[model samples]
Target: MTPAARVSAAIALLDDILQGAPAEKALTVWARNNRYAGSGDRAAIRDQVYSALRRLRSAAWAGGAGDAPTGRALMLGLLRQEGEDVDAIFTDARFAPVPLNDAERQMPGTAPEPVALDCPEWLEADLRASLGEDFVPVMTTLRDRAPITLRVNLRKSDPAHAAALLAEEGIATTPNPRAETALSVTDGARRVANSAVYRDGLVELQDAGSQALAQAVPVADDARVLDYCAGGGGKTLALAARVSAQFIAHDAIPARLRDLPDRARRAGVEVRVSDAPAQAGFDVVVADVPCSGSGAWRRQPQAKWDLTPDRLAELTALQSEILDDAARCTAPGGVLAYMTCALLDAENAAQIRAFATRHPNWTVTETRTSRPDADGDGFFLALLRAPAQTA
Candidate 1:
């Protein structure tokens, strides 16, 4: 497909997304319907769709739609913002976006702070409360694609060795400062899945912040660890790389962990997958619970628009419940790791504080909160110890 045709496809997909269709579903439908579109065309269209979604408000406003906008208007605004020639992509020719009229050709005026930063007005206050002075800057950063990062499985190979293996496959990487095992994909990021390093379990795709959080876990040698909510078992696997421990991964929905065994086998790690907590007295218990995912908007922009106050409250409640249960499962004097991929205070420190209030004997040993940046996604990890026994 031509570049102009890709933009047109993106406009249609965006319209579907705006009308309540999930971005993934809309893209899949578009792909199945347009069998003639090659892999390159599909990838380009997907990029355009996601890029526009990331900066929906700013793009819409710039396209002269002010507060009200359509998908076509949003794309026009996105091009305008990027300093691209609007006429080139919107030729009004076959399979191309309609040309901008005089009204759309006119440059947009200034928008409100939230709109200017591409943040929803309703979430502005909450985001500001969480991010403080970095709100605007952070939001601006989230309006772009996040860099791909991978965690070197030290059990198999070191970072340097892993980089060499990846380079052999035409995939380039650089050491990430966020974590000792973290590597940022510098080139051929799309080839990571097919790279020998990744296929051979030398490295696993993960956010640098997540790698840092995993490193922050104070897992002792031979300690038994329980991942309370091990969705896809990413953190569980990270912890496994650091310690020779007995690992058990459990989730509320067992289906979520269906592939964990295969993943563990590929990574050459032992992780017992369970639908429920089989036994208690774990040395370390990690509750990486449900969250609003405000910190990961750059990678999953649709989530930003789908989140609601009620859903956030539900997630916080669930997180608190999981923390409570996970704390109970920790062995006496064991460590409990409470974590989330959310920037909201209510989900991070606030939940920890509430846990402290409920169990004054449990004491916080360490707390780490990483803000979203060029190196990593935002994340929070709090390590607490169960009360020691007294004779």
Candidate 2:
């Protein structure tokens, strides 16, 4: 498809997304119906759709849509922001967008702080407070694609070995500074999944920050660990890759773990699926509880707009409850790793502080954080040591 045609396709997909249909769902439906659009066309359109979403508010403002948003306006705004030739793409050609009128051709005024940052107005204050002097930079960084990172299963292969194997398959990689096991894919990323290295479990797709979080876990060589809220078991596999511990995975919604067993097999790790994880006596308990996913908005931009204050509050409440349960599962002298993919203090440090207040016996050990930056997505890890004896 021509570049102009791709822009037109993006506009239609954006309209479906704007009307409350999920971004993924709309894209899927469009692909199924427009099967004539080749793989490259679909990928290009997807990039355009996500890019616009990442800059939704600012793009709308650029397109002169102050209160109401439209697909055409968003595309125009995105082009304006990127300093692209709007006339070239909106040519009214057979498969192109209609040409811009005098109103659209005119430049728009400056956008509000939240709009310019593509953050929801209601969330602006909290994010600002959470990020402090780095708020602007962090939010601005979220307006682009996240790096495609892979976690080398150290049990099966090291980063150097993984890089060599990936290079043999045409995928270029650089070791991630955030975690020793992580590699940032520089080229041929689309082929990584089908590459020999990945198929044989030398590496698995994971964010560098997440790999760092797994590395932060303090465990004994023969420790018994429970991933209390192991959604899809990424953390579980990560932990197992680093240690020869007895690992167990569980989630409140059991169906979320349907693929974990296969993932474990591929990674050469044995992670027991547990339906009775609550009756735990674990040396390490990892609680990667759910959150607003604010730090990962770059990868899932639609969620950035979907999150509401109420939903955030509910998440914090749920996080606290999960912390309590995870704490219970931590054996005496064991470590409880509390973590989140949120940059918001309400979900990270503040939650840990509240948990400390609720459970006086659990002692906070160490905390590490990385706000979304050049290295990786925002992640928080806090280790708490249980009392030497269970009282």
For every model shown, what is its TM-score relative to the native structure?
A: 0.97, 0.98
- Candidate 1 lDDT, 156-250, residue by residue in tens: 99999999989988998999999999999999998999877788888999999999988888888799999999999999999998888999999
Candidate-wise lDDT, in order = 0.89, 0.91
Candidate 2 global TM-score: 0.98
Local error of candidate 2 at 289, Å?
0.5
Return model 2's CA RMSD, one decimal: 1.1
Give candidate 2 regions above 4 Å deviation. none
What clash count goes with each model? 0, 0
Residue 176 error for model 1, in Å? Answer: 0.4
Q: On residues 257-329, what C-alpha lDDT tens digit does candidate 2 reach at each position?
A: 9999998999999999988887857999999999999889999999998898889989999999999999889
